[model samples]
Target: MRSHGIVLHSLRYGDHRIIVDIFTEAAGVVPFIVPQSRIGRNGIKASAWQPLALVEVAWQPNVKTALQRPKELSLWQPWRTLTIEPRKTAMSLFLSEFLYHALRREQENRPLFEFVTKALSWFDERDDQFVNFHIVFLLHLTRFLGFLPNVEDWEEGCYFDLQAATFSRVRPYHIYYLEPEESALVPKFLRMDLRSMRAVGLNHALRHRALEIVTEFYRLHIPEFPESRSLEVLAEVFE
Candidate 1:
């Protein structure tokens, strides 16, 4: 089965083999093993299977498939900015980690796929002023994951109740709540898209804080969401 997919992550296995987790149009999320040759084998190159790379994958399905094999693979879109720009690369790494953990289902989600595809393209074309891209990406991603923050309850003096996944005039009695100021940023993110991402104004501290809040918001919603190891690196770049 030929499917277009995004490479979520890849791990090298032993010597010449690599295992990749891909979110595909046909199969949702699936793992594949790639065997590299000595040289000039004309197979998929190791560099080709990069994180968040868009590619057309030829899936080799199995009867009791724990991991599928790719008969062929080709790059779909080459991201010039994301490849060469260090900040964008770091941002992409963080976002890729979030996607790896957040999108757990092995089922097709065309809408989510479409949204991600467009967002990546936007990231590739846009100039360097978009520091808040990841924040907006993380917040908007909640909509597809089925836990979009309840913007309805957003009002003055209301805190975001992470536990209830909504807003409230009174704060929750736990640590999983956002302060009023932090809560206010949620709607700003909700209203943002890739094109208007530059309109969000925040200092280094506030942006970092908002990213933390978004991370916590995801962790609250997704029990298995892993701690983002790339977070510290991303924060450093922003600072």
Candidate 2:
């Protein structure tokens, strides 16, 4: 079968072979085994399996096997600076790890796939003003995951209830809620896009805090969402 996918992450298998987790448009999230000989052949280097690298893959599907080997692979798009730029690379790494965890067991979700592909291209086109990208991405990603926070009651005195995924005039007694200041910002994120990112007034502190809130929101919705290791790397880069 022929499919297009975004490379989520790869693990070194034995010495020269590698196993790649891909979120494919046709087959959802599937693992692909790339043997030693195929890695560097036809400009498809092993390094090309980097996080969020778009690729067109031809592979045979077998009912008995979990991992499918690609017969043909090619870069779907050559990202100009995502891999080379420092902060962008950091953001992509964090996002890649986030997506791997978020979409690991997903079935074929076309809308979700389209959203991710469009967002990656958006990142590629933007330069340094993408500090809020991941936070925004995570916020929107919730819609697909089925826990998108409700900003319907967003007003001057409203607090966002993460656990209930709703907004309320009365503050929740639990800890899984955002403060007024933080809650006020949730409405902005509800309509955020890459084109409007530069207009956002977030500094390093606000960005970090927003990230914390969003990550916590994810934790509330997703069972056992572990602490992201790439987070520290992102913080350092932003600092």
TM-score of each: 0.95, 0.94
Q: Largest TM-score belongs to which candidate?
A: 1
Clashes of 1: 0
For candidate 2, what is the TM-score? 0.94
Model 2 residue 130 CA deviation (Å) reads 2.0
- Write model 2 residue lDDT over 76-175, tens digit each, in one string: 8889889999999999999998888888888899999999999889888886777788888888889999998767678887889989988898989998
Residue pair clashes in candidate 2: none
The prediction achieving the highest lDDT against the true structure is 2
Q: Per-residue lDDT of 46-155 in model 1, one digit per residue for the tens?
A: 55589999988997689597688888877887778887798999999998888989886647999999988888888889887789888888889889988898786799
Q: In model 2, how large is the Cα lDDT of residue 144? A: 97
RMSD of 2: 1.6
Pairs that collide, model 1: none
Q: Give all candidate RMSDs, comma-separated.
A: 1.5, 1.6
